[model samples]
Target: MNRVYNFAAGPATLPLPVLQTMQAELLDFKGTGTSVMEMSHRGAVYTEVITRARESFKRLLNVPDNYKILFMQGGAIGQNAIIPLNLMGGARKTIDSVISGAWAVKTQAEAARYADAAPIIANSCDAAGRFVSFPEFTTWNRSADAAYINICTNETIHGVEWYPSDAEAAVVNASGAFLVADMSSHILSRPLNVANYGVIYGGAQKNIGPAGVTFVIVRDDLLDMQHPLCPAAFNWRNVADNDSMFNTPPTLSIYIAGLVFEWLESMGGVAAMAALNDAKAKLLYDFIDNSKLYRNDVQSKYRSCMNVPFFLNDESLNAAFLEQSAAAGLAALKGHKMVGGMRASIYNAMPIEGVRALVGFMGEFERQNGQAF
Candidate 1:
């Protein structure tokens, strides 16, 4: 069977060239006569892979010299606890979070266990109670001397994102706190200002590589603030001090991630990807906005470029839509259960051709089903 356009939120898709390169190198990586998976993490060959991966990430994001990029194991969920365990140990134990969607709620709930997790800054919903928009910066209610304020830059399930803005950094600075961002689903999809954040973390499954590794970029000052109870492996200071090799790292995933970084460089880096993503998002959103049979409830300004969730006008057609879309070579269009609808996750690896095909299919589905709705 031919490769289908994958719209799943995570472990989503990799660039074809990256996959092909991995296939070519799977048996004997860089003439080592052993697979990357089989090599020791401390070996010179594997060290080069991890170093290149880390350096490429820093270069692509333009990360500052004061921040350490450590490839740790644990999905974003695990960081919910890990973040507080590290940062909340200081005299300032308050963590303020803006409730954007489901993931933000979870991250704050976990932080509550370790710190004085304050009331949410603001909800994404408006007066009508639709999870379609984001709170304005002026509306934020922050705690005094809070250790850090958390925000998920992108909510994968609800298809909401905090669009790039300087207001977030301003708020953090004014509140006497650093910013901790969960950029799991949309980290590498656009250009970023790394200095504005104290820590930026995300899982590798979506835009980076596979499932085993999680990337954390932390400023130098935050490294030593971990609680004594924090495990050596989960401690950012220890992880950085040992150069992300305190324990065996995810060798294969790091290798593949390095290939992806190189691929992104060849494709003109994140700024170029951002342009392509905007075009793809425009194509899909424009179609949905003009369609009578489908609607995306997300507010125009806050809608995520990486994930688009839309509902059919007639709910009864959802099963048929999913079935037919899959049979037509589109996969994982089902929305998260918390929100019942169809979601198309177009991450970095997904091509514009795939988005065009999806728009074509959606148009056909709308045409055939419009009379009923």
Candidate 2:
């Protein structure tokens, strides 16, 4: 059976080519006669898989040699605690956080439990309690001696992204505090200046592969900043030193992530992906802007290309729209309850075909239901 277009947040869809490749190598990986799931992570075969995965990831991101790429088991949520535990060990207990939406709110709240977490400029919800734009950096109440500044580059649930200009990044970097970011939803969808960030992390499900693997790229110097209470396995230094194999790692997930990295490289790397992603997002957003019955409230400048949350003018038609969209092979269009209507998470795995299919369905749905309201 043909697969329906999956737009759920994550563990989101993956490339069909990657899935097919994994299927062909499922039971006997490269003549090793064992599934990636069954192989010893320490074995030479598995070692090659993970090493190549890391190398491909580095190549795609242009990660500096001063940085270490670690494949860990915790999702982004795990890093909520791990970040503070690792970074807040110095004299500065403050971790200044930029709150954009749901994940940003949660990231700051989680950090406060371990350190002196302070909100920098959180305008996550507007007067109408909707997240439409990111707060300007000038308004940030950034601490002078904060350990690091945590920013969720993309708000997964609220369809807002922070695409800072080079000048804006220069201002942020001037703060002297370490720059840490959660790029879970849009990690490899664009090119990133790895040098600007002291730490950048993301869960693999959305763009890379399945759940169970999380990638954290950190500056070499920050690895020594682990809190005394931080678990040895979770410590960046311990995990990085051990090559992300402090214990039984997420071998299967990492292997699949390896396949994803190779797939991305084959498609001319992140720059090509960024251009395609821009086109897809523009198509959907332009349609939404012109629609009579649908609207997206996110500010044009701060809109997320990875996730588009939209609403029907007639609120009651939500269920019908979702039902019809599913029947038309467009699945998981339901929005998060916090800001409900519909959210189509067009992550890196979601092809332009999927977005075109969704736009076609939306147009048909508007025609069918517009006159009644």
Candidate 3:
């Protein structure tokens, strides 16, 4: 029972209760005399599981009735191209993107392959070329004839989060274009207004479940705009029509996600999770801000609550810090190579005690290494 606190970005940490429940039923789920993985996806028992999962997810997120939740494969990376293929055939045939960090850039690049013109509406880079702050809403140069405006709500690598402001909401509302968000890393960590976006999607590995399932919540009206080249499985309209069984959906992963939804509900849903997440993020961010040996690059207003990327003041100490942290029962403290620093991803499954442990370790490490740096 010696479990270390895991902080990997995806395929990260899941709630222990959910994991235990799964372990309890792994061999024979619900008296069916078979594991969930062995059951037929189209069978009555499996159908009940998927239906409950979708319903629980909808209830937790308060998803609008008009939105269809499709469980598809390919994660967010696959959605990058699929989104453009499905939505770019609109009359405008253009995609307006807000470049915040790595994922947004990838999505925009993929969209460009299908869009008539994919333009950068806003970029969150400073004059020094660091992706630290989000560009103001007024500074966004949106296309007059864009099919959809794309934005990554949270950048997992660069550690920036896009919190919707009144002005930003007003701007999007007036644009008459569908708002598309890549909410992969921070999807259910906070409460979201599902009505605000035409499409919201993410990979389940981050905070929901395993890596096999990707969830797409699309508005009904937007489903009919797929390009002629869109694949039957990747097409949102077709997937929705087939109830996300256009291909064999991620059966086992979806089953785990269903348990997570139930766990969230028992913990008071997204609102409660948001409050706890705020506390966890604040604890770590405040510690880093006050420490002389560590520093976080992203601007205060744009900091990601889920993924907090920080660097040691002395580059030479990076390896030592990682080694010591792992020895001390902290795992996956290494940052993405794109942003070479230490990243602590404290997702919903991370309790405040974990963040407190991290902060305590940071303080001790600084105490020993501060004078030298």
Candidate 4:
């Protein structure tokens, strides 16, 4: 059987080893003669699955003991509301958002409902509404007493990412506000100093496993500040007390994510993964930079390692390029509707060979269509 290279943004491609493990355990997981999907979440078998998943996640990310890893049902969009609900109970009800792209803009809008949401709009977008760079750290006016400052670490649609450095950390710490990041698109692709952020959350679909669960890592101290209306299940403090089993939980997805965590460990963990991710991003970006036909608009310093959004110089060939790419075993090359052109979401599961193949296809398409205008 032939497997095409998949580049969907969410419910994205998963590591082959994880998929193989799932297949092996499907009929009778761990010799129990029951598929994980059919088994009870409360049973010892599934309990082990979740426990192992959490511990492996902790180890892989080097999470501090003070952090609680919660397997949740809501996606990032859910967290937009849940974040304010859980964190705005403090006397400081305001939530400051650092907007870089569409997701961050939406985050600010959602936070506005539950708290004093203020956005530090990035000067990163060009006059034509194109993202060309990231806002300078010094330019951000983060709220000093806000409950937390929300930022999307990587803007998938705009192909902009924040790779925090020592200088940036100092700026972030000086704000005297809790740092919360939505690392949905690039969570496991690199190593993050979990100490730098109050909350680190992402949907598991991109790098962990399939959809259905969003894994969250929240500092223990931040758990208690939930609004009065916050649901018991959505409250970090309550979810922590219940061990993420307050509800049925996403059993099959958790089980699969556990396999993925183990797989990441076997492949030398996040540090090694970061190195590979760097090489993959560089290979693709180098090609795009050299090709007059294709160009990535995001500033080089802030370009995403996971999602690379590029446009062909000749817009007329967009549909045909996608059609030809699909025929060549490349799927989901279409960019988000908000950003016209093509986006290649090369997540952890997307091997280097996939990017290489994609570059080859782009080259061939360019040659056939006409020279770069």
Candidate 5:
């Protein structure tokens, strides 16, 4: 089989080993005479899968004892509403969101349905609504009783990342507001201080396993504040109390995520994955920075290690660049339509060699187009 390097943002490339392991167990998992997908979610075998997966995920992220990781079916978009619904009941009706990019903006719009959302245009570049820099935490106009502070830590579309430093954490902590993070693109890529945020949620398509599962890690105290109007299944407290089985969970996706957790543990966990991701990102970003024709517009400090978005100096060459990339086995090099440029999403499963291949292809394309490399 000809395997092209897939640069898709979600439903992205998974580790080959994880896929092979799943394939090996597909038809009859552990002598059960039934595929994992075919098994009862309540049965002992599936229960074991759930328990181990939760433990492995906690270990991978160093989740604190206070955090409850709930595996749900709705994607991150769902949490945009669920977050406000669950957390806004005890506080003022307003929710403050740090608008960074497309996802943050969308999340704020979704939250508006359930609460009064105040958008703080934190840091956005004039061109393409890119989030190249974040507003200084001290400058943010936070409300005293805001339900929570929402941040899209990694914006997949604009390729911006926010790794909150100690000072930033202190600022947020001082505001008397809960810090909620949408970490869809960069989850499991590194270790996160679970104590720093009130909630962290992500769709399990990039760094995790597949598209169906959405992981929500909420601090126990925050879960107890669900609104009376919140749906039973969407209530974090109920979901946590029921152990993520308030409704029929996404069983198959959870099983796949379990396998992925095992795979991450085998790879020496998140620290090792962070180092690998850093190397991959550096190779591509360094190449782009040096190239005369290509440029990555994101601020160096805030640039995402997971998704690298760049543009050809000559916009006319965009089609040629994509065509050549496809011919060279580097597929899906097109940037999101909202941000018209090329984006290479080098997630956990994207090896350094893939980055090297992409860099080499970019160099060749630049040379052919008579742009100095």
Candidate 6:
């Protein structure tokens, strides 16, 4: 009955309360005598689930009335093509991408397939192909008639985050382009002012629930711009018109996400979650900063609260570190292969005690390894 503190980047840990709720309703959901997964998506039971989930999400994020929350099937990668396909109809053929890391780079490449031109506005990688920091907003070369400007608000692999600032908003607004963000890693970790961007899309696996469900909140005005060739299923307008039911939705994933939304609400919603996440990030980052053996490369101002990527000063200790951490009940501390280090993803389900335990384990590991931390 032991549960390790899981830190996988996505399809990551979920709240125990949410899991319990799902278990309780697994066989019979609200007197229906059937699992939500066993029901028809078009049935009344499913309708209630979708409605409550959307409304809970709206309340939690304070999403505006002008935005439509579409529970989609494809992950953020799907949105990369779907976004341009839907939004590039009337605007110029060019799409501007601000590349911050691997995810953003992948997004730009995907956008190229849909748009006539996909221009890199700013690429943050250095000659060694390391993502150290975000390019300054002033340094970007935006297109005059660009269909939209795309940015990954938090680069999960590189561990960079962009807090919405007036300068950033002004820059996007001045270009007369819709601001689209891939917020996959840090979607529900904090409060977002939805009006600041035209579209915000993220896979639910990280901060929300299980895989197979993605959420896209698009401003209403951006719906009608889809190209004639856009697939009916991928078209935002069609998805919206059908209320994200054009095809059979991901029922189990959506239902689990609804349970998570309810769990979040019971725990005092996103504002409270943001405060908790801030404390958790600080706990881990401060330990990394002060430790002589471990180092975090991301610039302090842009470091992600959800994903903290750090490297051991002695690269030889990587395997031992992971093994000992696993033995101590800390799981998935391995960093992405592109970045050879350790990454601790402290998502919503990661309690403060988990971070404290990890810090303690790191200290013990350094001492046993004869390194001063």
The whole-model lDDT of each prediction reads: 0.89, 0.89, 0.90, 0.86, 0.86, 0.90
* Runs in model 3 lying further than 4 Å from the true structure: none
The digit string of per-residue lDDT tens for model 2 on 1-373 reads 5999999999899889999999999988889888888989999988999999999999999999999999997899999999889887787788888888888888888988988656555455787877788877777777887888888889988898985566766776787776788999999999999888889998989988999999999999888877899998899998988898998899989988999999999999999999999999999999999999999999899999999999899988988998889999998999999989999999888899999999999998999887867
Candidate 4 clashing pairs? none
**TM-score for model 6?**
0.97
Clashes in predicted model 6: 0
As a whole number from 0 to 100, the lDDT of residue 144 in candidate 4 is 66
Model 1 ranges off by over 4 Å = 126-130
- Candidate 6 overall Cα lDDT vs. reference? 0.90
Candidate 4: residue 202 lDDT (0-100): 78
Q: Distance (Å) between predicted and true CA of 218, model 6?
A: 0.5
The worst-scoring run of ten residues by lDDT in candidate 3 lies at 162-171
Model 4 segments beyond 4 Å from truth?
121-123
- What tens-digit string does per-residue lDDT give for candidate 4 at 192-272? 888888888878888888899998899998898888999988888878888899988998889888899999999999999
Please, what are the lDDT tens digits per residue for candidate 1 over residues 131-239? 7876776787877878988888898888988853677697677767988999999998989999889999999999999899999999999998888899889999889
Model 2: lDDT to the true structure: 0.89
Candidate 5 is scored at a TM of 0.96
Which is the winner by lDDT between candidate 3 and candidate 4? Answer: 3
The sequence of per-residue lDDT tens digits that candidate 6 reaches over residues 1-373 is 7989998999899999888888898889999998899999999989999989989999999999999999998899888888888987875788999989999998999889888889999988989898878877788898888888889999998899985576677678777887899999998888988888989998999999999999999999999998888899988888899988999999999989988999999999999999999999999999989888999988898899999999999889999999999999999999999997999999988999999999999988888886433
lDDT of 2 at 238: 88
Cα-based lDDT at residue 232, candidate 1: 83
lDDT of 3 by residue, 237-268 (tens): 88999888988999999999999999999999
**Which residue pairs in candidate 6 collide?**
none
